[model samples]
Target chain A: MIQLLRTLGHLTVDGVWQVGFATRFLFAMLRHSGPSFARFSLTIRELYFSGVLSLVIIVVSGAFVGMVLGLQGYDTLQRFGSESALGSIVALSLLRELGPVVAALLFASRAGSAVTAEIGLMKATEQLTAMDMMAVNPIARVVAPRFWGGVLSMPLLAAIFSTVGVIGGWFIGVVVIGVDNGTFWSQMANSVDFREDVVNGVVKSFVFGWAVSLIAVFQGYDCTPTAEGVSRAITKTVVYSSLMVLALDFILTSFMYIGK
Target chain B: MNRAILDLWVGAFVALGFAALMFLAMQVANVSEEGTRGETITLRARFEDIGGLKVKAPVKSAGVVVGRVAAIRFDPQTYQAEVEMKVSAAYPFPKDTIASILTSGLLGEQYVGLAAGADSEMLKDGDRIEMTQSALVLEKLIGQFLFNKAAEGGSK
Candidate 1:
């Protein structure tokens, strides 16, 4: 019984210590971010790896998700004889919820895990240590660029996902199901407010980007310097960022949509 | 990848992202269309019960939208619901135009409908549409029907 209590206390203390460490690491990354902006090409190179490379998965998945929404929405809306509303239903759902949330989840697994693994491997191989010995700031040169790359990539990726998804929905809802084309487009335009739905969705993605990037870089930087530790850190990056994205999504949605 | 190739790919990616945003704003949300709807003048109407008439609900004339509901207020003294509509300047109605609450379908959204009057004077901004009709309540209609049936049966 005492062993169990000791284990629980140890875990509680470890978790709190890690949280404090992460907060400090975040400030360090911010302080060292000047190189990322001043030497913009370095950030762009990282963007190519994280952003451009992730495009195929984001677009293909977005299309499939949208098509599924269209099929299901049509089946249900037809019962109420309100099939004309399918456009708004699909667009609103994609923009308001699925676009930012699902895209961020995918990003957590795809780029977030990769960022962790890359940084963790560099540490394990003593590359970061060598940079410090050579009087080079590894945090500025290595970590900051990758972090900004992710932050810049997330919103653009989310936008592309939603746009592709809307087209996929259109294909299923309009072309295959025989809903009136004009009605579908007009209904979508009439119902979706640019400021209310679209702008809020962009904001949600931006916040998610900031969170997922920070968590990814922090995990990589704080991991134990060993092979096994690097693998575990990569896993933690995916898991923790996914959870953070979902929790933040709930808070943002409540603030944006509830009450009015 | 080579630096030039990387730059090109990033440029293309950024361009595509912006294009997607443009599609959302123009094609899906109709931002430009709303901007081009022309200047509008406000008109007021009062009803006993507005039903589900929401702000931004379309105000139609001859089955075509000419305006949108701008505000809805309640009067304490007369116990009436006051609605303010912003109608486009292009479409002008006479002073005696009737504004009535209407529903599109049985269970669909409610809107405001205007029936023009053959009067010489045109309605202007901040003018009140005096001839106003309240929304039709389904419960009230059913109750009246039942009452009428009971009255006939008692007479018989």
Candidate 2:
């Protein structure tokens, strides 16, 4: 067990170094590619898949989140004789943290794994080799598109999640639960700042997007030429990317508060 | 090919509709926009803490929205939060009105709730609300309760 722990520690150190190397490599690729007009077009295609295709899940999940928050918040506030603050609570939580984080996790699980699998299969089948033989950079052609797509799509999806979630909370708090409309909206307005909490949420989404996509592409690209290897790559990408999103969220939140 | 094209168009329209709905909902829940109406007067309240407060949060009197919070800032000198609220012109507030930071539920958001005083003098725009209460943070309250219980147990 002691030997195992030592090996695990060594692996973790190596993993961190590998991540640092990949980050620098990706940055270099971005710089060398210049405007990357081809990648930009590919990014739009990816946005349609990752952002537009995920709308139903985002809305449905957002509604339930909002409704649950409203019901629980209202019940609790009743004890303190301040039941009207439900809107602010719902809005602030959704905009600042919940919307982006949850949406990104869901996106990573559904799409990030798929992206990894697709790329891993291509690698296993030697399609990437063919591209290399043809004098095309696979990272520039494939990875860059997915990376930009995830970054762009994440914020759009998060915005949808936040808006739908707030509306869902309003439906439950106001129409069903009988909280006054004026009070609900007023509390939401009084407690939230558009430029601060909301913008912060959007920025976090963009970061999460880049991180998830890069993790997926890297894992996929590194897969051995075997079916099992492709499968493992897909699974690892989803799990690792989701964990990265949460860890990054904590770091970002600490930075936002402590830096200012 | 035509069927596939038609399906794509239908999907695009649905997405557009969803986006529009979301935009409308935001407009409805927007407190800042509502405050822009002609019959509203803005006031400021200072608190030690404004926990999980958002810009669009409501200002209430007896569970009714008399206004919304317009802005929030931290005072460098006092280290207190200065909250600017826009009250409806129809609701008359006395100069001595008490403003308190209150929770909606046990784990709910915090907002400023106003309790009107009997004084005849009305509050004006930019006037300060002197009787302001800070947020009752649950963690602090829980810690205090636990400490008291432990102390009592030790004494006994």
> RMSD per prediction, one decimal?
2.8, 8.1
Off by over 4 Å in 2: A32-39, B1-156
Instruction: Give the least accurate 10-residue stretch of model 2 chain B, judged by summed lDDT.
Output: B20-29
TM-score of each: 0.88, 0.68
For model 2, the docking class works out as: incorrect
Task: Please give the range of 10 consecutive residues that has the lowest summed lDDT in model 1 chain A.
Answer: A251-260
Which digits, one per residue and each the tens of the lDDT, describe model 2 over residues A91-127?
8888888888999898898778878888899998999
Q: For each predicted model, how many residue pairs clash, with residues at least 3 apart or on different chains?
A: 0, 26
Candidate 1 docking quality: incorrect, acceptable, medium or high: medium
Tens-digit lDDT string for candidate 2 (B48-154): 88877766577889987677788999999999999999998888799999999888867766667999998899998779999988888889889999999999999
- What lDDT score goes with residue B144 in model 2? 99
Candidate 1 local lDDT, residue A250 = 93
How far out, in Å, is residue A13 in model 1? 3.5
Clashes of 1: 0
Per-residue CA lDDT of model 1 for A87-185, tens digit only, reads 999999999999999999998899999999999999989999999999989999999999999999999999999999999999999899989999999
